[model samples]
Target: MDISRRDFFKVAGSTVIGAAAYSIAGGFGSALAQAPVVGSTQITNGIQSVGSKAKVYFTKHIDAAHLIKLYDLINEGIYGKVAIKLHTGEKNGPNIIPRDMAKAFWQHVPNSSIVETNTLYKGDRYTTEGHKETLKVNGWTFCPVDIMDEYGNVMLPVRGGRHFKEMSLGKNIVNYDAMVVLTHFKGHAMGGYGGSMKNIAIGCADAKIGKKMVHGVPLDKELDEAWDVVYKQDMLMETMAESAKATIDYFGKHIVFLNVMRRMSVDCDCAGTSAAEPTIPDIGILASTDILAIDQASVDLVYASPHNKDLVERIESRHGLHQLAAMHDLKMGNDKYELISID
Candidate 1:
């Protein structure tokens, strides 16, 4: 049950009073109390989706003009240099955003760069050169990660994100006048589904920092003495959460979050070798300035689908993924936000 922002406080106050009244005089009054109102906006952050434009589009019939959707919120001079962060897929993975999509999206923006960094795990994806070679072999030679023409420049660096006092590739990304993040919305083995936060946070950070982001602390503090597979998972979660915070801090306010829910995958593009079909049907696209709101909406839709309940169940059972709970705890973003609908 969800309530709109305007009615949240009223509902909350009434809820408290009703609970007390029930304790004093239990009866129909309790039953009559606010029955978890459906669609009651609960997350009380500055992000009220009210009066804001959601701007939902899809590629069901017509291929979406994603950049035009961006143009809706963007105004001239609002930004000069824009950084386009996307997943170029992992070692053996496919379904990295299609090259055609890249050509279409990157071509639209002015002074934009196609950006990606390395990974922490010792693999072929560890170095820029190795990653580049992987992309070419994977049929990504046409659309490269860092390609600079007269209009825009793309780059990758050694260290990135807020975790470090100074990123080796510092200021180049941070110094950007404006940022636009394009994420292929999909489920993640780690964080349930890699939404805007995961896409930008881990995806934007260079390989060194990306590794740090995935190495979360052990879930069991006692496990410190026991660093096995159990400990590894915990550390990765911490990395996702910690590195996620960096992604949010750096780009949350300055960037726009966009997703193409078509051809959703259970794992991120990084899982290059294995292929898992999307658990659910395509839901189209969503764009938002508020990262949390968009993610919340994304989760809402995912959890709503009967085919995808496994994710929700797994998240709840394993790491409390219903809302990517750690994100709020780590202060990357909140689950509650104001979702204003635009055309």
Candidate 2:
């Protein structure tokens, strides 16, 4: 999806106008409204699954019922090309979504892209081949990377990057009609938690872009660095939220956020170790079309969990950052992101 700066303007212009029209005619703009709104009725009425007491599945409990419920909400066409943006862990990591798990997860949404994106660091994942090799050896198979296809057009100009100077994306994603983001909900070393927002920035960016965002700056002026730890902390919160906003600006309704809160770890999946036992066990599954609301509720769950409460608050305080606060300030979505809880 590398377009010339001139073409970038064109994409922006047409996208803005079309988005406006979509908002006016389809109420798509209502989602970005600052005011909190709740749907007393089911916006998911025609979408609810046939059977099941569970509206959202539980820990490692992703069963047929769960898939059916999720599928009912997203399957507009009998067989459509869907993209499941995943988090393939680091070389030393044991947390990459298991292929068996991923296969089972996408069974309901069959014919998916199993779309793996590039990382943003120089450590191990500098190239797509590296990413592909790591994933394949680790049991990722449903969808593989095309060596001939350069998804991240870092070589050219990215369309509309709020903070990013340019972003190279694959043509597949730019043309993707529908996407189901499967995120592993866990606390990041840099941020309080890596949820829907980080999934887009870190999960979607190419190695070059990803590393820049991660190592951009460290906070603390007194520490000799111009940016404070807290400042850098807030920067990521800002960057992640803004990147998420940009993604929505182009493809809002087409995206759905699904956060898996099992194995609630203190570090990001990139850490590449067997994740620690949950401080507060039993983090459940959450489903929401609203990116903002789902993150808010998931963070609350982690903070409320005993093992995580200390780390969560400590990190937020130490860094002067909170994902929800940053996302709220950006108006990513309203504070009233209603929770359709599943027992």
TM-score of each: 0.65, 0.70
What tens digits encode model 2's per-residue C-alpha lDDT throughout 1-343? Answer: 2236325534433111112111111111222322122233222223443331212222335444564465455334223456777677777565445566667767667666666555544434446667667766666666543321244322222223334433333334554445677788876776767787778655654343332443353211122242344236666676666555555544545667677777656677777765554465646666666677667767756665666675575457635246677666655664443345443
Model 2, global lDDT: 0.53
Model 1 alpha-carbon drift over 4 Å, by segment: 1-62, 74-78, 139-144, 147-172, 217-239, 317-323, 329-334, 337-343
Q: Give the TM-score of candidate 2.
A: 0.70
Candidate 1 matches the true fold with a TM-score of: 0.65
For model 2, give the 10-residue run with minimal summed lDDT: 15-24
Please give, for residues 1-343, the per-residue lDDT of candidate 1 as tens digits: 1125214322332111112111111111000111011133433333455542322222232144644554355323225667777777765566566777677777777777776666545456666667777777765555435621111112221122222222112113543555666788777766657777677556654442223324432223222343444324444444454444544444334566676666676766777768576667766666555555567677776776667765565454435353355454444444554333333
Go through the candidates in order and give the clash count of each. 31, 15
lDDT of each: 0.50, 0.53
